[model samples]
Target chain A: MRHTINLFLMLAAFWLLNSGHYSVLMLSLGLGSIVLILFIAHRMDVVDHESQPVHLSTKLPSYFFWLLKELILANISVVKHIWLGNSSISPTLTTVKASQKTDVGKVIYANSITLTPGTIAVDLVGDKIMVHALLEENIQALETGEMNRRVCQVEN
Target chain B: MDVAIEIMSAICLLIGSFLCVSGGVGVLRFPDFYTRMHAVGVTDTLGAGMILIGLMLQSQDILVIAKLVMILLMTLFINPTASHALAKAAIHNGLKPVLDNKERNNTESESSSR
Candidate 1:
C-alpha cells in the first residue's frame, strides 16, 4: 500500500513535469491515466519494495555524488589512453567478489563498474562479477573493494 | 556572476565536444568490440553528461533545468544496462577479450571459443 502511494506520487510528479497542463479536463484525464496505470502495475505485481526502493532513496544521493566523482576521473584516464594509441592499453578480465546482500545492491555494484569508463561488468553470477577493463590497474582498483563497500553501505 | 557562468558553460561544452570526438577516435583506434565499448561508454556517460551540464548552466528556466536533470538521470540508469547486455551477448557468442602487454599485437583477438 505504501509502495502504491509512492508510485502514485512519482507518476503524478512525472506527469506534471512533462505535461505542463493544470486544466480541469487535462488534470482529470491525467489522473485517470495515472490511476489506470497504477492499477495495471499493481495487477502485474511490480510495485514491490525493490521496484520502488524507498529504503535506498535517502542513500542514493551521496552514493551518486561519489559515483560522479569516480566517473569524471575515469573518463579522463580513458580519454588519455585513447590518445596514447592501442599499445598503451593493457586489457584485463577477471572476477571481483561482491558483498551485497540484496539483488538491488548487486545490480548497483555491477552498474557502477559498467558506468565507469575503461571497465565493463561483463557478467554477474551470484556473488561474483566478471569484469573487463582497458587497463590492468583498473582490475586492481576494483579488487580494492572501495566501490563494493560503498554499494553495501547504500544498501544498509 | 553571469559572465562567470557563461565562461564555465562554454568550457563545459568545449570539454564535452572533445570527449565525444575522442570516443569516436577510440572506437576506431581500439582493437576488438569490447575495448571499443569502453570508448563508447566514455562518450555515453561523461560525454553526454558534460554536454547536458553545459546546457543546464546556460538555461534560465527552472523547468529546463529539471528536464536536463531527468535526462541525466535516465542516462545514468540506462547506459550501463545497455552496455552490460551488449557485452554479455558478445561473451555468450564466444567473443574473448584481448588481454596481455609488452608482447601484445592485435586489434581484434583472432580467436573464438566455440
Candidate 2:
C-alpha cells in the first residue's frame, strides 16, 4: 500500500517536472497516466519494498553526500595517476567479503564499489564480491569494509 | 551575485572538462579492458556530475533545477549498473585482468603449494 503511494508520488513528480504544464487538461491527463501506470505496476506485482524503497528515504541523503565526497577524492586520485602515467598504476583483482544480508544491500555495496573511480565489482557470488581495482590502495580501501558497513546501515 | 554564480559555474565546468580529458587519456593509455572501465567510471561519476551541477547552478527555473537533479540521480544509478553489466559479461567470456606482481606471486605460491 505504501509502496503504491510512493510510486504514484514519484511518477507524478517526474511527470510534473518534465511536463511543466499546469493547465486543467494537462493536469487531468497527467493524473490519468499516472493512475494507468500504477495500475499496470500493481498488476505486475512489482510494487514492493525493494521496488519503491521508501524505507531508505531518510538514510539516502546522507549516504549520497558521503558517496559524493568519496567520488571527489577518488577523482583526484585517478587524475593524479593519469598524469603520472601507466607506470604508477598497479592493477589488482581480489575478492572482498560483503556483509549485507539482503540482495538489495549487496547490490548497493556492489554498485558503490563500481561507482568509485578506481574499483569495479566484477561479480557477486554469495557474500563475496570479486573486484578489480586500478591501484593497490583501492583494494585496501575495500578490505576495510567501510562501504559494506555503510550499505548495511542503509539496508536496515 | 550573478557574477559570483557565473564564476563558480565556470570553475566547475573547467574542472569537469579537465576530469573528462584525463579520463579519456586514462582510457587510451591504460593497459586493458578492466582498467579502461575504471577510467570510464571516473568520467561518468565525477566528470558528468560536476558538469551537471554547474549547469544546475546556471539555471534559475525550479523545474530546470529539478530536472537537473533527476538527471544526476539517473546517471548515478545507471552508470554503475551499466559498468557492472559490462564487467560481468567480460568476465563470463573469460576475460582475465592484468594483475600486479604481488597478487600474481600470491596466486602462484598458493597454487604451487596445492
Candidate 3:
C-alpha cells in the first residue's frame, strides 16, 4: 500500500518535472498517462519493496552523499595514476564478502563498488563478489568493508 | 554573486573535462579490459556529475535544474549497473584481470584468517 503511494508520487513528480507545460489539456493528459502506467505496473506486480524501496527513502540521501565523497576520492586517485603512467597502476582482482542480507542490498553494495572509480564488481556469487581493483589500495579499501557496512545500514 | 557562481561553474566544467580526457588516456594506456572499465567509470560518474552540476548552477531555472538533477540521478544509477553487467559478461567470457601477486596473497591470507 505504501509502495503504491510512493510509486504514484514518484511518477507524478517525474511527469511534472519533465513536462514544463501547465495547460489544462497537458496536465490532464499527463495525469491520465500516469494512471495508465500505474495500472500497468499494478498488473505487472512489481510495485513491491524492491521496486519501490520506500523504506530506504530517508536513508538513501545520506548514503548518496557518502557515495559522492567516495567517488570524488576515487576519481582523484585514478586521475593521479593516469597522469603518472601505467607503471603506477597495479591491477588486482579479489573477492569481497557482502554483508547485506537482501538482494537489493547486495546489488547496492556491488553497484557502489563499480560506481567508485578504482573498483569494479566483476561477479556476484552468493554473498561473495569478485572485484577488479585498479590499484592495491582499492582492494585494501574494500577489505576495510566500510562501503559494505554503509550499504547494510541503508537496507536495514 | 552571479560572477562567483559563474566562476565556480567554469571551474567545475574544467575539472570535469580534464577527468574525461584523463579517462580517455587511461583507457588507451591500461593493459586489460577490467582496468579500462575503471577508467571509464571515472568519466561516467564524476566527470558527468561535475559537468551536470556546473550546468545546473548556470541554468538558474527551477525546471531546468530539476531536469539536470534527474539526468544526474539516472546516470549515477545506470552507469554502474551497465558497467557491472559488462564486467560480468567479460568475466563469463573468460577475460582474466591482471593481478598483483602481493595483493593476491594479502587477500588470500585475509580470507583464510576470516
Candidate 4:
C-alpha cells in the first residue's frame, strides 16, 4: 500500500511536471493515463521495496555527493592518462570482493565502479565483481574498500 | 549574481565538452575493447552531467530544469548498466582485456571461470 502510494505520487509529479498545461481537459486526460499506467504497473508486479527504496532516502544524498567527488577525481586522472599515451596506462582486470549482501547493494557497488571514469565492472558472479581498470591505482582504490563500505551503508 | 551563474555555467559546459572530446581520444588511443569502454563511460557520466547542469543554470522554467535532472539521473543509472552488459557479453564471447605483462599469463586461466 505504501509502495503503491509512492509510485502514485512519483507518477503524479512526473506527469504534472511534464505536462505544463493544467486545464480541466488536460488534467482529466493526465489523471486517466496515470490510473491506466498504475494498473499496468500493479499487473506487472514490479512495485516493491526495490522499486521504491524509502530506507535509502536519507543516506542517498551524502553518498551521491561523495560519488560526484569520486567521479570528478577519476575523470581528472583519466583525462591525464588519455593524453599521456598508451604506455602510461596499465590496463588491469581484477575481481574485487563485494561486501554488499543484497542484490540491490551489489548492483549499487558495481554500477558505482563503472560510473567512475577509469574503472568498469565487467561481470558480477556471486559477491565478486570482475573489474576492468585503466590504471592500477584505480583498482587499488577499489581494493581500499571505501566505495564498497559506502554502498553497504546505503543498503543497510 | 546573474553573471556569476552564467560564468559557472560556461565553465561547466567547457569542462564537459573537454571531457567528451578526451573520451573520444581515449577511445581511439586505448589498446583494446575493455579500456575503451571506460573512455565512453566518461563521456556520458560527468561529461553529460556537467552539460545538463550547465543547461539547467541557464534555464528559468522549473519544468525544463526538472526534465534536465531526469535526463541526468537516467544517464547515470542507464549508462553503467549498458556498459556492464556490453562488458559481460564481450567477456562471455572470449574478449580478453589487455593486461600488464606481469599478469598476462594468469589472465587466460582466470577468464575460464567468468
Which scores better on DockQ, 2 or 3?
Answer: 2
lDDT winner among the candidates?
1
Model 2 agreement with the true structure over B74-107: per-residue lDDT tens digits: 9999999999999999999999887776545654
DockQ ranking, best first: 1, 2, 4, 3
Sequence-dependent TM-score of model 3: 0.93
TM-score of 4: 0.93
**What fraction of the true interface contacts does model 1 reproduce?**
0.88
| Candidate 3 per-residue lDDT over residues A1-156, each given as its tens digit | 899888889999999999999999999999899999999999999999999887888999999999989999999999999888666788888899998999999988998998999999989999999988999899998899899989988999
Clash counts for the predictions, in order: 0, 0, 0, 0
Q: Model 4 chain B — which ten-residue stretch has the worst lDDT?
A: B102-111
The lDDT values for all models are: 0.91, 0.89, 0.89, 0.89
For model 1, how does the per-residue alpha-carbon lDDT over A83-152 read when each residue is reduced to its tens digit?
A: 9988788988899999999999999999999999989999999999999999988999889989999999
Runs in model 1 deviating more than 4 A are B101-103, B107-114
lDDT of 4 at B20: 95
Q: Chain B alone, TM-score of each model?
A: 0.88, 0.87, 0.86, 0.87
User: Please, what are the lDDT tens digits per residue for candidate 4 over residues A1-156?
Assistant: 888898889999999988899999999999999999989999999989888887778899999999999999998899898888776788888899998888889988998998998999988999989999999999888999999999998988
Candidate 3 lDDT tens digits, B20-104: 9999998987766888898899899999989999998899689999999999999999999999989999889987776665544
DockQ of each: 0.78, 0.51, 0.46, 0.50
Give the local distance difference test score of model 2. 0.89
Number of the top-ranking candidate, with TM-score as the measure: 1
